[model samples]
Target: MPDAARPSPNCQSSHNAADPILVPGRTCWRMEKADRVAVIIDAAAYFARIKAAILNARHTVMLIGWDFDTRIKLEPDDPMPGVPNELGDFLSWIVRVRPELTINVLKWDLAILKMPFRGGTPLVLLDWISSRRLRFRLDSAHPPGACHHQKIAIIDDALAFCGGIDMTTDRWDTPDHRDGDPRRVRPNGEAYGPFHDVTTAVDGAAARALGELARERWHRATGEMLIPPPPVPAFWPDDLEPDFRDLPVAIARTDPMADHEGTQKTGKRGVREIEALYLAAIAAARDFIYLESQYFASQKIVGAIIDRLSEPDGPEVVVINPERTPAWVEEESMGSARSLLLQRLHETVANPRFRILAPVTEGGEGIYVHAKVLVVDDRLLRVGSSNINNRSQGLDTECDLAIECAPGERPEVCRSIRSVRTRLMAEHLGVSVEEVERTEEATGSLTATVDRLIRPAGRSLRPLEPQPLTETERRLVEERLLDPDRPEPMAATILRGATVFGDVNRTAWRIGAGVAAAAVVGVGLALLARRNGLGKKMQGE
Candidate 1:
């Protein structure tokens, strides 16, 4: 693997502070009250909020996502009189009901193209674009081989949602994550894994900024300018009431433009912003660092945490991921890398203050972890589209909101955020928050919880046992590592090279060959256009 030490221009001097000193009573930042922010805990809440925003939109609706399934129902069981249940039907109804309103949708072109069986069906969206006042486009051209992986929705420039959640089937789940709940429906009647995710809703200036982001995406996708939507009426759902008012929120966004011109200047890769933000938050942490992410494969971050753990006064670090990667490739590539990284960290920290956990229901259905959140010292909080993985930081465009809590302000808001994380841990361990807290208080940190549940009798720490991989799984993992665009190319190349000729080798070879062929085709097309009159025309010669 590449020496995880590539000099990052985004790296700043770490502020090795012990804990965040509470700022005096509710120091209101220059942000507006209408510019409030609320964290949506799971996919269900995310979709419900988007549905509400769309329904309440007075002038415009804009959406951008890495993946979107029109077949997915926004309101699975809500008996609302006029609400459309499924996404496609709901969108169509919105156009029909509000003919004058403009709506735009943009999705990653590759993701759309991946579903070849649905060929020309995107024409349905194109037709909607043509027939109604709606506009739909597919975005493909980002940094070469990179993806536009942001998920956002802006309604009439009055409300916006930004996060890791995608509006696809199998994503909706309540916080309860009840085992084998018949109420949860999979499109093909196949049972899906339990999952968790988070998104943010913001109004006021921050909302308008998100609208700008949607407009920028639309322009990149279609070369068409988007006009800002007119202001809309306050339509906050009764269920989404603010946990605390007058909270100070910071709207932090990531884009290629910033990389190309901003202070960090990590080139077309926006991972630097995500990394810098994470490291800065880590240094700023005082009490503890609580995070929930789909994957953990960044060794640099693990190193940083190890450094912190070496400090006697450092805050605790907690991570939640699925027990195993869902696919063979992930298991081999990210799963193995994470396993090794965690072991290294564990070895460095004598007491093992850091932890990685997976949530499971009583019935043994593995929770598909997808939430992207960070709570630092109970003062700094973030919820957004980026994961902790390498792809999210470097190869994909992501956006997140980071907020600093005002001292003596609604401390309950901070408590609420902590409660959510603790509650998740409780669900996984089948223990109560009070119990976890009591144990932590007695033992000094989360290590006690892990030691109690995971360790064998008379053992202080559990042995670093790797998940078993089948031959097919091993081959898939090898292939993922060989891919340069993946997060850990060095590890992938080494591991995959060793098993590239095994029984599962053909499958890996085919996939690699396909990606290479696509890259050739893309480059050939670009060169041909440049040589012909097409490029000149595109350049407006």
Candidate 2:
């Protein structure tokens, strides 16, 4: 058997600062075991793998997400033939054919209320309710401003995927992230921007852990106890190649400390497991840390990075982020915050060891980097839904899976980690993995390796140039709505971040946001009322 298939060799964990093994409760929620693990790079690969996994499910499939769109195609271009390709049709068709199979879907309640605007039809959603076996629930289990943000799918408790990719529209793009790919079109006939994301697939114990998490969430939202389906003998997807086998994969979570009214829930210490892991991983780095995330507005994380960079022999830090934020308020908040953080990181670090970049297609079109991944010193690999934003660190409910090759041991695993990082770099650079490997060997620095592979044209990663924020934007940064340290109400956050925005009259912009927040609550309540009415009408029928 190949070295990748062997059990990861264990190294004695030390609490010593100089050499610490990430511990349970300190750096993570639980250090569970996995029979095999594979890191899927993009949604194009992930969606197909999910389709296959669901097809192979013998008993149950559970999907938990921030949003769910029934229209997205599981296998868009070359769909699975015998059954329909759309996610709803495919799932329902399979269950119809195999009556014993059942699928449970849970999505954030507010997100569900907005689904109609995104092109979901009532008839189709009604189809979901038509099947008693297809249990669908909208989750409203969190404090104000907090979201049930985990994206997870567990099949028969044997295979599971956890990461940033939502099984929804505008999420299926290839590594190339081309601007004009026909498969990138939405159900509404308009093409969306190219997207980039990732997820980790694990079998056996790791899958069971995620399944357990999903069930706990189900109980919290709907008061239904979900039972784990009997384990299946074998169900790994055929196309995927495992990156590591029989590895100890750690699962971590973030649950809001407050209740619906934003008041602190007594005795509920906020789950900061993911945050602890972030700091520990940054502290553990010996050479480099490569990160790709959707948002980067967490001050605590930035402080940790600065601390590491302050070291005389600090490791290089390379970050990949989208050039422009997707939402306007996000730009006002995280975008502004990023500029401030970059400036501090640039001025405070001893040397120019910190670097950030945004990915662009070979045609020079920007491709969004929505993947949440971190690799440190060719030993630690983390892939999941946790972003570097404040909400992901502690406010919203989240799940992240991570694995590490122990310090001073497991050269094979070390090489594998390096290989995964190299491949990712190569994908962004539009070069072969061999080229990345050669560059790494020559330079021994991630920054230098990336600089070497940058081309004049075509797919490549470009340096992220921070933009100057206006005085108003800077004040908003202090308000922390976009980069709130905790999940709280928008109006309160905005008012506070103001010590913090009128670049239009910035006051007008601020007021507009406040009004919008009110409108959203008003909309949420209206929809909630409508949902209740629908429930009553259905009962009568």
Best by TM-score: 2
Clashing pairs in 1: 1-490, 19-286, 271-393, 481-492
Taking all chains together, the TM-score of candidate 1 against the true structure is: 0.79
For every model shown, what is its TM-score relative to the native structure?
Answer: 0.79, 0.90
Tens-digit lDDT string for candidate 2 (205-278): 87988888888777666666777798689678888999988768888777775332223465566777788888
- lDDT score for candidate 1 against the true structure: 0.63
Question: Candidate 1 residues 183-221, lDDT tens each?
Answer: 477655666777777788877776777777677667655
lDDT of 2 at 162: 95
What are the per-model numbers of colliding residue pairs? Answer: 4, 9
Provide the clash count, candidate 1.
4
The per-residue C-alpha lDDT of model 1 at residue 428 equals 55
* Candidate 2 clashing pairs, residues 3+ apart or interchain: 362-458, 362-459, 472-501, 475-500, 476-500, 478-497, 479-496, 479-497, 502-506
